[model samples]
Target: MSEAAVDISTSSANEIAPGIPDPYSLPLDKIDVSQGELFRQDAHWKYFERLRKEDPVHFCAESENGPYWSVTKYRDIMHVDTHHQIFSSEGSITIRDQLEDFVLPMFIAMDPPKHDEQRKVVSPIVAPDNLAKMEGLIRERAGKILDGLPHNEEFNWVDRVSIELTTQMLATLFDFPFEDRRKLTRWSDVATADLNSGLVESEEARQAELLECAEYFIGLWNERVNSEPGSDLISMLAHGESTRNMDKMEYLGNLILLIVGGNDTTRNSISGGVLALNQNPGEYKKLLENPELIPNMVSEIIRWQTPLAHMRRTALEDTELGGKQIKKGDKVIMWYVSGNRDGEVIDRPDEFIIDRPRARQHMSFGYGIHRCVGNRLAEMQLRIIWEEILKRFKKVEVVGEPRRILSSFVKGYETLPVKVHPL
Candidate 1:
């Protein structure tokens, strides 16, 4: 018998129709931040601020996704994130529960032993030593990308610079055919995109794109399986004892994980950094004056952007957290975006501080074992890009409001129009 498919009938309220409830009119406890519209319009900050102040571990009884406990405060989010044993990452890591028919078992959504083993297979690709070797190449590519940009004219920075640089890096990581690298970006987008987000016309189209992704990777796997192990992610999985036996579905799952893991976090930050610096002229001036601060500023940009808004974990057992009782199998969302901005934990969390003393102390890369493996690599790319930007351009001026991605999962810009004025 063929495997079951995703239930097209099941959907978030936002996907079902085309409206978000007025979060403002709802009672303080009634407001749900899971709605994609909140992030799309960039109206989530105030809601998170209210939750942090009044109800740190706020529960929304109903949402477009489902009932979920939103952990907004920094300390509380840390408690849940650190104690992964109690808050299991199994099944899914997004607010939306995985469909029974369509399950993708990536390590990030797996519990220990399995998660550790699979993650270890790919860890070396982004290990400190590997990152050190990559810096020169990253800087070279960044310089080329910056030089290639149109001068003194408006262009979508998201497409021209952000996506191009990161996609190039991703292609390199997978040892993918350089000519077809944009397919990697398309698959990454489709993997994170929602049906109502205009990325795909319907659920059917999204599944078709992902299936195509799976099919494409299967051919790569076949080629690698018979060859000597190389440095790319596919070879790592092909040779690693823990991952060598991954089924087509499992291989596809890990493929999506690496693609999005490699793509979105860095790509979004590339665009977010320019937008942040442009918004805060003083910070931009500080960066221009002292290029030495670019490394620290990279961390601040990651923290400030919080590329991924939240990561969900299901409760393994009944537990008390931040004065709220979480039942077994309950959906708990740790809002990294909110925690990064919690003033109690981060001084002036709302402000973009380029030279923040504890700049690296943020939950954007997450906490504990699941902390982003490519963090150093992401920082290196940002630092190199900014260094290249400073060398060639006086300013990457943001000329209009960024068109934010319609996603609470991937907090990012779809387009950021900017004009580069050369030094």
Candidate 2:
């Protein structure tokens, strides 16, 4: 951690001030749902509930990331997500504008022709054929991980299980050096860590770590660029016509995008599913009675967890959304976290029902063009892990409260203490 970084576990910029009123009690204009502390404390639900009901397309005139519009309803968020012409993804996808001097131009942050071409370059990796090929390996690795856990002894499941499995999968995707696989996890954290989150001390430190990530990947790029075209991600980028000519920053940007995409969603969901099942004991009982529900439960887990809370877009033109006028260039945030729990679309929105009908209809994987490229892979990983867990464990008990990551952008866990009881 950087010396300049504050330990957000103890103090955070977004912490509700002493004596501040509850989410509904506060003035509508005073509600800023972008606060990291609200998510960290797991106290953000009621805030979004208020916004979804009273002001679905509310604007906060002031926030740490500056003024922005919050689109909380499922339909409105789907509108912003699908209509790329109106809500552009060109600038930054998070509320915080990318630092002018340190901008990294990955495909997710690019528009049209360029974005389409670059996305096509790597999309093949997650295609149906490739996912089928990877399934056996994923299941084999997942079983080995579960077999290694100490029975009836408390341990941080996020570190021991979640991080380990995802890091291994990331290494295989990139064909990276297996011994240094954890570096991918580190870079993912540095790329999205809030300055006050204590993950990195300052903006300078964050950039420094990301640059080091760039240097390491650059070495791999050099190795793969000259070789015959290969199936690994590094080789795909090195040889793809659309991406072959990318400059250093653009390369780094795409690398960070893939790393975070591959790691965060599955890793966090693996941890989140356990915590969710433990909290909703009846759901766990249902799953134990019938393991066939794992696939549907995987989708429900992603919806309930909403690993990535919100994705920000820049309004490209003046538009009317939920009766609010959004001006050109204004930052618009689609709160997927809130939209996933929208009552208008999802029945019993707050409950975690593993066998819920149309479980796949949630917005955890954003809609339209920028939807998660690795959506299938994320689901497969979660399903495989849970299936293996059921085969070996009677239950995986959450013994302590989870410590959540202090960033609204990456809704995830830092640690979750648990104990496994063998079947």
Candidate 3:
């Protein structure tokens, strides 16, 4: 470790820019800080305020995950995501289980022309027109799930609602067996959150688990390969215009990326939305009264909830960010949690405002060429779920404090207990 300590004393360190958050002082990634702390302290804003202020790209000496540069400001994170040449997500650049092989990661983890080519394959499928094609089905799926809720009973929102609906939707998209859908959720979580040797399981056991997940997807893929055409994401990926006879391992690798992409991230967003609305009852009422706002409200919820709190990016070449020196291969994590609540870019940066004019401007879905490919799909699921939720329940209130997961890679409630009563 360098004996040189960083000085975050500059005024700019306290704030990113006028009207936005103080990136310097926000405690965005101190996962040691509890979810209650996250909810109560606006620690994210403070951590980002400091990052944006004193060391926009300096290392976090105290992070147990090790010294990662917290890129708190919105523009800084954007720069890293878009400038794939300078920074890379191509391989182990992602902190999750070191990229065991370079064969095939997803467009999300790739760079340049290659990433763009793969992204184009399903871009049309998730486009507004294609999503509109699946809208009624998506809405109906949400309705069936919500309509079955015990009107007068209390339930954990993540388990009963978010997990069930998201896993089911992904099951529908991939044609995976619905009865075993929870397995998909688990595998996806393990793929991302197993972190770098954080799990107690033996390395062989973990690799076996990942292979087990890829096996199930293989079954699904084989079935799709032999079957007739259908209008779903699997079919799109399987029979894409640019795809050829890609190797099984490579195919499985990309499948893992898609599953991880399509599963846990959005699931957390769904769960986070519920927790946000329940905690801020006024915002909950805002949606209940004006259902039209569901579209805009989705943006607000994503901004406030800030699910998928941070993502790691490896610097490919030696570079200087916000005056801090970053050597080649150093791991840096962008704290979207802090960037989303940036005070300089937002009005009342600490409070949840469903009507925040720039709520859509948040970085939760990421930015640039490698921005989330499933963004539209995620929005579709969220909007449909909320619409049906509003129609059936007059009020959905939280019964207690929601608990966050232990892992920092994906930050969301483990359980969102709620009281769901009929309208």
| Candidate topping lDDT | 2
Ranking by lDDT: 2, 1, 3
Please give the lDDT score at residue 241 for candidate 2. Answer: 98
Q: How many residue pairs clash in each candidate?
A: 0, 2, 30
- What is the C-alpha RMSD, rounded to one decimal, of candidate 3? 7.4
Assess every candidate by TM-score. Answer: 0.94, 0.96, 0.84
Residue-level lDDT tens digits of model 2 in 62-155: 9999999999999999999999999999978888899899999999998898999999999999999999999999999999999999999999
Give one digit per residue, the lDDT tens place, for model 1 in 1-423: 001111224444433122444344568867888988878867677678888988989888988888999999999999998899999999988897777777888999999999999999999999888888888998899999899999999999999999999999999999999999999999999988977888899767877888899998888888998999999999999999999998877888899989998899999999989988887899999988999999999999999899999999999999999888999999999999999989997998888889999899999999987888888888888888988999999999999778889899999999999999999
Candidate 2 Cα misplacement greater than 4 A, ranges: 1-20
What is the Cα-based lDDT of residue 303 in candidate 2? 96
Model 2 root mean square deviation, Cα atoms: 4.5
- Score residue 259 of candidate 1 by CA lDDT: 95
Deviation from native of the Cα of residue 86 in model 2, angstroms: 0.7
Candidate 2: 10-residue stretch with minimal lDDT: 1-10
